[model samples]
Target: MKKLLFLVFALGSSCFLFAQDETVQALKKDAERTIQKDPNDTTSKTWKTGGFVGINAAQGSLSNWAAGGDKFSLAVNGNLSLYAFHKKNKHTWDNTLDINLGYINTTSLGSRKNDDRIDLLSKYGYAIGPKWNVGALFNFRSQLFKGYAYDDDGNRTFNSNFFSPAYVLLSPGVEWKPNNEFSAFISPATVRWTIVKNDSLAAVGAYGVDPGKHSRTEFGAFASLNYMKEINKMFSYKSRMDLYSNYLKNPKNIDVYWTNMINMKLTKFLTLTYSLDLIYDDDVKLFGENNDSPATQIKSMLGLGFLVKF
Candidate 1:
């Protein structure tokens, strides 16, 4: 449903962009002609729309090593992003709606599992000065496939064993681009409140009330910093960092996570990427006892990918 919503928006935007009148066409032609006279004298005068797609093959390790086989798993991921932008007079505005869908299936002969996830994102921003802008970020995620379980007696007791997890988040923040190559978003910290949650493990049998059964709100501050250096015209080096923290009120717990990614553009259509994710979770006391110790988990991935823009 979330994917379909974005597809509808993309189709509508395409139709709107191609349905421009003669007046709009004349203005665009004049603007193009004027810019052709002076290569350096470019001003905001029109609107444009575009999209991009990317695919990658990656390998990573799953924490806790479920299924008791191999800790490493192969992952294939893909993303689709669409944007519409307008430039008028001295101000420019850009709106991007993106959808990400990916699946990772792992197998070690007898032990196997599949994890599929989807994300829908929307961003809207307007330029205040040359490199200063403010934007809003909205995102949603849903888990499609979850595994099943059986009793110690080797009999199927529960027919539905897996739960679908989903989240809806809205973040309002400001972005500053000091130069054409460096940009960052900071302020109000984007707080992603969890509106929908379903976890089968938390709802089965006696341990059913463990914070994951129903809707619960998690508070977090979000920040993103990106730096890019252009190497020639089609290649560049990019680095991005994202931080999030969730404070659970009832459980009296705190969860902090950070993801850092570095990518080298091998060509106009390909990239080599490396990502590291670190998570720190505080001790959780359940029934007057903590299940596990307060520890840190690290996960990393390396992959080569292709990018396409339209």
Candidate 2:
């Protein structure tokens, strides 16, 4: 059944790419028509605003994380992003700035809890005379839900109180488009900062005592490269490689992690996304006691969701 599900997702992704091509083509044609109709109309402007909202529904199992479930469970996840921007001229070199905001919410592994996250991002870029474009990005993330806990002696305890964690990142990037259908992006020195962390369980002795309690800060850097190629007139191939590291304050510890995500559009409104998450960290105390060795873990998830543009 899982194999069959994967096959379906693959097919849907292929079809979605075809639809993207058609949409882009249609937009291009419209722009050309508008330009040709008024050769001397320098006062007219060309700008576009659009985004997508999606609803995702699926059934799967999660593992590796404490408080997570190993048994089959029904899950739902969704997100929405909207933006509007304008460029002075299509041929003239002009900078474009967009304020993009989005939110995502998903059910926990046991389906008894929920995780909600919100993102506020800004992207600014300018064409450095043609094939090269440079940009900077700022992103903020907030985890807006409570977590589960157990009694001091290991008995399960539940509550309704919740806290949120905040993370911020700054990235300066460059995009090179050798031609019309192919492009690549690299962000060499992106920095991420975590301003808040959860530690209630540790204070209560459910998780071992730690030097840092309540909220703490951590600093990290990441580098990633992404390439996309247009296949035929309707499909495109996308791939990315990333490396990240973090060093936490007191109770000194470090961690490194990587993530890979592949998404295929099934249509103008639907997309299939598959992700692999991996982490490797040095000895540390989790829930209060000392974890003896460096741990490496991998997690995977696949989901289908709708994408809408307005």
Per-prediction RMSD in angstroms? 18.0, 20.3
Off by over 4 Å in 2: 1-36, 43-48, 59-73, 81-110, 113-121, 148-164, 172-191, 197-222, 227-273, 278-297, 304-310
Best by lDDT: 1
Each prediction's Cα lDDT score? 0.55, 0.51
Candidate 1 TM-score versus the reference: 0.52
Write model 1 residue lDDT over 1-310, tens digit each, in one string.
9999999999998888887766699888888883336767776448788766778876766668656655666777665657676667545555545444455655542222222335454555677777777777666655445433334443432212122334566677787878756667664545554332344434532122344455444566666665646566554454545555553342334354454445566788897766565655442211222223455656566668997768
Q: How do the residues 1-310 of candidate 2 rate in per-residue lDDT, one tens digit apiece? A: 9999999999999999999999999999988884345766668655556555656676556667688654456666555545454555323222222121223233432333333445555545667857777876566655446544454554544422333245566778776657644444456566765443445543542222243554433445544444445454334344444444543332234353444545577887687766565655442223334333345656566678875546
Clashing pairs in 1: none
Which candidate achieves the best TM-score against the true structure?
A: 1
